[model samples]
Target: MWSFVGKKNQQRWLWHAIDHASGKVLAYVLADHTDAALKSLMQLLTPFGIEQFYTDGWGGYARLLDEDQHEVGKHYTQKIERKHLTLRTRIKRLARKTICFSKSEWMHDIVIGLFINRYEFGLPI
Candidate 1:
């Protein structure tokens, strides 16, 4: 998922793979930018032999997915991309520049993970 720090700030970050078929968010980490984000995402994805993957024209995605069965530069990734937008809208805290409200990084992870699992995965809240 590509996310920005705020509407006023352009600093973007990513959360790793979301299983579109199952609506399971496989992994997530706070990253610095697209490069670092792709590196971590690749690491997380190494175990899975994906037959095909899709993404936007993020340069880092090109580099990492070069070895895999990736389909880039297409509009097919729009679904997962839109999911990020839904998450940002639903989770007010994730919306731009709201506050430094995470109690701690660990707590932030737990809360966000739970939220994603409940809301994104259609699990019972």
Candidate 2:
């Protein structure tokens, strides 16, 4: 799943693939929430051999993922939703209403990338 950042029309999405068993973020893509964007994320996850994708009823998910492998429902996507909540709590830019926001898409992506790299993946920035 993904969340929007920045103002409307100028917003960007932070798409994520979370491992249910480990509760770790697998891959993420920063882009518009489109089929092409989701396709890129799926490509990144291809090496992991993901057999099933549980996501919301997003048209992109339904269109890109195989019907049999796609499970559309809120119950199945709790982990990712919780991850979204964590992101929102930790990243002020992701908050629903906040004056602090990235002025450029470059800064937006870099900030979020650093956070995920250092905090989520435990890599030194």
Using TM-score as the measure, the top candidate is 2
Q: Tens digit of lDDT per residue, candidate 1, span 79-124?
A: 5667777777876656645665444445545656777778756777
Candidate 2 local lDDT, 21-67, one digit each (tens):
98899999999878898889989999999998888787888778889
Worst 10 residues of 1 by lDDT: 2-11
Give the CA lDDT, 0 to 100, for residue 106 in model 2: 89
Each model's backbone clash number: 0, 0
